[model samples]
Target: MKPNLSLRVSQHLALTPQLQQSIRLLQLSTLELAQEVEQMLDENPFLELSSDDGAPEPDPQAPADATYSEATNADQISAGDENDVETPAVDTPDDWEGDGSMDAAVEDGEWGGDGTVRSGSGADEDEADAADLARSHESLTDYLHRQALSLRLSELDRAALRFLIESLNDDGYLEDTLESLAVGLAGADDAEQLDELVHRFTVALGLLQSLEPTGVGARDLAECLTLQLHAMNLHEEGDPAVVEAALRICRQPLDLLAKRDLRRLSQLCATGEEDTRQAMALIARLEPRPGRRFADVERNAIVPDVIVRKTGRGAQQSFSVQLNPDVMPRLRVHDIYASALRGGRGGEGHQALQARLQEARWFIKNIQQRFDTILRVSRAIVERQKNFFVHGELAMRPMVLREIADELGLHESTISRVTTAKYMATPQGTFELKYFFGSGLGTETGGNASSTAVRALIKQFVAAEDARKPLSDNQIAEMLKEQGIECARRTVAKYREALKIAPANLRKAL
Candidate 1:
């Protein structure tokens, strides 16, 4: 067989560096972006804070020029206008003025008296940045060691305490018993020493319980609440009656307290309804998680991708398709250093420096392109899912990457990258970009409903069910069928699980 060469024209998708960078930047959470920016700033000397670009100055001499300057920005300058063309100016306030020269204006402000250096002065105070709560809390072991320092315990005892602290879970509860702890510590120098260590640990246990969250370091709920009551008991030293009342409440069965049975609790405490109520109220106030108070709270600051506000026009809306600002690196190429390298004034490393300079520019450019791509994709999403904005998930039409890609005149994979990990803020709530896409479930009529809407409907049915006889998955499926949903019982169960809900048996009332 002869191998024949033929020319064919076809369409294909490619993953360019710019496209890859765009995808990476699009999905990054707010905190992730800040970290990325910091990394870029360190690697690329070219980048600087947007605020460091320069501060606004009052210039009476160029009032008209100031107005023009105000209008000029990164976005405006980048977009060309054929009819209204602009040339690089000789004298300007910027570090790299419009002049063709690569050399930056000196510290003398030869360009203008308003030469604001893009360094330390008035940088953008990383506003609307992701919450960095993870950094705030001290580790359990570190806290235990610090507490141990105040106690008059032996070195072996301190070590035992450290081990116990290490054994404590994230909720700050010690998981092992004294015997188990002793067994664990037996690997040390002496067995007798381990016994002594256990004794010291008992004292440390009290200290841990007393630390915070009132009830933390407790092995169980009963112990946890009891520990908190004990703390409150200690604070009521002057009032003997109050102290006695607290002790009685602690000694009683915890099931009564958990159920919030006030009348029975008053009788059990052997106090008046008011004092018992106060004690019950006090018990309620004590935190179950002593360590959780100190534990780092993972803060997920939701930034809405779309901002819809009511306007004078008939339901006017605007979508601010912003990249998580934190992720975009604040960069500006070092003109002075770059020029020196280009001019061959620098040594062998000049080549490397030039490469770094180019990389920095490329990164920034890619980032800008990523934001633009996200904006375009998000706008397309809003356009297609406009009904969702007016109504809600119930109104959300079935969408897929192909649909969006076709609309945007881009490849399906490009649409995928835009949607993946990216989120958009809507009037309903902030949702991942992918939330808009779902397979269509046909109704009895020609119309279709999203899987998300069906799940929501199922949730509503379950919420309104009789608690004594909770609606089973099969029952829910039947109900959906009645409503013309045509869903299977297993599908109902799957959606229930996805919603993090248990089966009807588990959800049943006592």
Candidate 2:
């Protein structure tokens, strides 16, 4: 048999750089995207925060404008694409008059619409502003450097300390190997001096964990909690029941402890039910992941992509949906740079330069496509779940990716991508774009309730239940049936778990 040499033509989809970026940006949580953007800004000269324009102008009463810009900037920057992404324009407050101001404001707020931010000025305002600024947090590295200065160390030792501090991750763990630390510092001096410098890191590590939130500089979850417990003076003498229980709990899988298995835990700790419960309670207070706090606090604030407002006509009500403008990034490539590249001014690196330019352009274009897709998906949600806007989660109808995809005349995968990690702020609360899409639970009467609505209803039942006999998953399922939402006890348990609610026994009162 001869190998075929004849060419046969067929088309296949290729993952372009821009498309890849869109997929990545879509899936990234707001915090991850912010970090990625910060890193990108460092690597790309052309890419910068929209506010790198200037220190934001001072405003005393311009809450509306400030809110507007913040929301708009978040939308654009967070969307992560440059081309074809249309930022919905903000409506000036001037258009909204008298009682309309607050009504408009509430409407905007409900839908996460762009509006001016409230400002502070004057002596009183300055004091208020200072109080507000006090909440601003320092980076982990900055805090470590400040703490390190108080330690009495030689110049060489201090240098090593700084290196080790820098190497500590957000959780306060020494992620870098000592060998790598030595290599990194070797450039400053000879191998002998570098080894001495690296040896000094142990002292720094001990001190780093000793800082606020303890256990931050720990090597892992065990060390982090242990360090924190030690710092808190919670770790005590041998057979100190609380300390032993805490240690035992931490040593095992955190999930088992999270379940608060009173019986199993009592057996493990060689204690009675009361002692086991107490130990479990104490262990619950310990931070499982110390770094999560830093990552969460530093995360970018939510900027909704769409807003829906209720407008009434006579006895009838409807929703007015608007896309948020604040998160949009208004960017354009430098004309001079583009022209220079076209004129062959890049010389030897022209190919690389052109490639980068193409990437940037593609990035911008992909962002535009992302916005277009989001808009279509969001609109579909608004249309199908209009009842939800009018009457809250209780009125939310069953919806899924296929329903939206069919409505928008797009693929389910496309709908899935658009919904991934995207958020919408509503009167109900801030929810993932996907939250509005839920499977249906068929009712006895041949109708269906959204699984989301069922979850919400279940939560309401649990929250309002008697603590002495807190509603179990089985009980909750029964309650849902009373409300005409037919669901099983296991399904109730699943939803309860998803809401981070403990089991019936654990949720019960003392």
Candidate 3:
């Protein structure tokens, strides 16, 4: 076996560097893609952002009309790779335009037949600036510290309060017990020192809870609610009897309140049914998360990769999908650098510089391909789920990655990558691209109902149900059955939970 030698021929797929880059760029969210572009621009001398005025001036060192010579080279390189993985073509239909500008009329449900889509430029600009300003807001800790400055306290008390403020979680709840906090602070096993630290923490805790947001230093939900109730009582914000009843209810197990167990709450709070109901209602108005407003807005901000606008009216209704110009990076090969490289042939480090130029070209090509694929996929989604845009989530049709993948001559994994982390802005609201694809449930008409639509229906039923006697999952299921959808009670419950709706028992009013 050691001396054996034979000729063999085998074929296996391999992702080329450009192909890998294309795949990677396709999957990245708008923010991530922008970061990648920034990195490429920094590393490659040949790569630069294209001008808003259109193509750069023609390079004198190069042939006439060769301002974007690298673009042609890129096309040639990509075209010559016959055996490489299929990349989405940039040639799109006239209807499926990628020109960043959108028409104002399209948003008003009227297509002027120019095939152009434009949002309210002035309004969007102001809104974007406001959003950017909003995202730059201070963190919860910073906000608390700002309020702390107005306090007149000894250094020790101030330090303790600062420590407690920093210890609070994003939700404004102090997750650690004062004993543990004191132990951590004392950093010793001495009992007396620990007690002194705990006392300071307790004093600090009271002061911290009295902050502007209220309930900032609470250790648990009950404590947070109690603190807010006490504040309300002190301020005479609500009826005295109701506030007192709420305080009493907060002392009992929270599960009773969550379940809306009026009898149990009345028994535990020692209040009349009417008073308990009012107390529960009062508690509902209180903010459970005091620091939620201060949470980092930038982290949660979603920059959609595609924008879909409603076009036409009545019987001629249509959707115009376009790549979000804001998210798409305007990238190109540096004309001066590429011209210098082209003219100074066989110079020192010529090969390395040429490789970088090629890389820059590939980067631009891949970026173009990425947006093209996204546009294609988005158009397919809009075509299939057009009803969803017009009629909302209830009219969402059952769809899968394979359908779009097949229609676009792409692999299912590519479709998945396109959808993940990528969002689309539609009249219905911005949603992830994956939101359009959902598993189907069988219906009596031998058709399929999207699970998303089913979830939407469940939400509607819950919304419309009588508060005194909310519809149970079984009742929801029965209602769906009557509506030609064959959904199980468990499925309804699952969808309800997914929608974050409470159970019937919990949803019931006193």
Sort by lDDT, top down from the best: 3, 2, 1
1 or 3, which is superior by lDDT? Answer: 3
The residue pairs that clash in candidate 1, if any, are 33-327, 46-332, 46-333, 47-331, 47-332, 48-330, 48-331, 212-290, 213-290, 305-425
Per-candidate local distance difference test: 0.61, 0.61, 0.76
Off by over 4 Å in 1: 1-30, 53-168, 175-187, 210-214, 220-295, 298-327, 345-349
Poorly placed runs, candidate 3 (over 4 Å): 51-54, 58-130, 136-139, 177-186, 189-200, 269-274, 343-348
Task: List TM-scores for all candidates, in order.
Answer: 0.64, 0.59, 0.82
Name the lDDT value of residue 286 in candidate 3: 92
TM-score of 1: 0.64
Model 2 worst lDDT window (10 residues): 97-106
19-85: candidate 1 lDDT, tens digit per residue: 4555566556555666887888776775544453454442232234322232343333233221122
Task: Highest lDDT: give the candidate number.
Answer: 3
Task: For candidate 1, give the lDDT of residue 72.
Answer: 41
Between candidates 2 and 3, which one is better according to TM-score? 3
Q: Write the per-residue lDDT of candidate 2 for residues 1-510, one digit (tens) a residue.
A: 988788888755544344457666655654555576567656654333334343343223224542335445445433322232353432324432211101112221222111212111112223233223435867777777887788888786677677777777766677776767777756755878777766787766666666666667777776676665565455453336666566666677666665666677667767778766666666557776665555534244565666555556657665544455445444333445555666686466887876665555444444444554566577668778877876888888888788877765555776776788788766676678988888899887889888988888988888898988988777788888887778999899898899888888878754
